[model samples]
Target: MSKQRTTQPITTGTSVIGLVYDGGVMIAADTLLSYGSMAKSFNTPRLYNIEDRILLGASGEYSDLQEIVAKVKALALQETTNSMESIYVDRKLPAKSLWNYLRAVMYQKRSKMNPYWNDVVVAGWDDQADKPFLGTVDKLGTTLQENLVATGFGGYLAMPLLREKWRSDLSEGEARALLEDAMKVLFYRDCRASARIQLAKCTSDGCIVSEPYELDHSNGWNAPSMIRAAGDLDGDGGW
Candidate 1:
């Protein structure tokens, strides 16, 4: 008998989010790669800066994510070298074009029944249009653009928060605060999520990815004694 095709991923990351503010776009993802239920890598970054204008956040199989990043980087390098004058002449590919190219690649893989097993968020400044773009493509090659986007568990746990708070006039500081708050919610609720997060932004000037850092949760709310106290107050007998 012929073996059936396997669609499941071996290892994965989870809960990446992106949003657009008045001046730019921001993306965030935790640094955890899980092997099933086992927490394998505690510091695996799933967000990348592409072409100095795009910030890509990926969730799902790490190998597949790496492959997609490599493809984009290679294409960007070729475009930069072979069409340097075109780039200066404002004929280079913008963020929307890059996003569409990536979506096409993902869709082609899916049509061949060998999808990359990833959900990727692309955030960037569309220099040609002179505005920010934030969008996502899924394993099935489905794509969407919106003020906010999240993949994996973040879509469920954190998207609602963003949807409720996102505004067209949001400043960068305000948008980053909302994103961080959503990350905190994901960390508290998602078993596969971690405290360490990587954040990046794409603006008209350039893209910048901050070094990984752990969110502060030391305000005693996570303490067992606090939980017990709240439980006791609720008369649940501190079960």
Candidate 2:
């Protein structure tokens, strides 16, 4: 008789954003990880720095991703000598190479009949050419994407807005501003998303993860304009 396998429902997150510009790549993720209808937790660190130059932003199975991050970091440390010259070498693994490495790791897990249930965005500057790079890896170990990518529930709502504003020619400043706008829209509209976000910029210099900040809600674009219009119908400016 074949052994029975128990299946567990996946616990995951929502709304991760990845973009590349002239200077480097930027990735943003909300801190909420939802388990079905329940908003299970907050303050989850979904964005991870793999080694020095590469970053991995994930949107599922918090525990599994955490394990993956730990293993990758350990492997990176093991692969490098502790000498100053080796540490200073600019010829280490690039974002694309890291992506390939992760694909293999994820695939190995899947082949074991137990997989990490998360979609991931891998972003950084390519160590060789020193250019921005971005890619997406799904729970099934499929890796693909370019320019911009998003994962989780908010992905459906957020990616279209990003693609509308994203340009290959955009400078770092423009990309940051556009991403801020996109996050605001997602926060207001995405039920599973949080108003708080963590942003990271990865360049040839290195990865810089910002302090968490709240999405600006003061920009009244999403406020009830119709209600304001109705109040104005009386011409008194009172509602």
lDDT of 1 at 204: 89
lDDT (Cα, tens digit) per residue for candidate 1, span 74-183: 88877777676654543445677778888999999999888998998988887668899989999887899998899999989999999999999999999889988999
Local lDDT at 10 for model 1: 82
lDDT of 1 at 230: 40
Clashes of each: 0, 0
Candidate 1's TM-score: 0.89
lDDT score, candidate 2, position 202 = 91
TM-scores of the candidates in the order shown? 0.89, 0.83
Which residue pairs in candidate 1 have backbone atoms (N, alpha carbon, C) closer than 3 angstroms, thus clashing? none
lDDT by residue for model 2 over 1-239, one digit each (tens)?
98543255456677788888878889889888788868887777688777667888888777778877887787667555443357565345567877888888878878878878777788988756658889988877898868888887556787888888888888878888878878777877778788778889898789987777777777546465524555477745865
Candidate 1 least-lDDT 10 residues: 84-93
Give the poorly placed runs of model 2, Cα more than 4 Å off: 1-10, 82-91, 219-239
- Model 1 alpha-carbon drift over 4 Å, by segment: 1-6, 85-91, 220-239
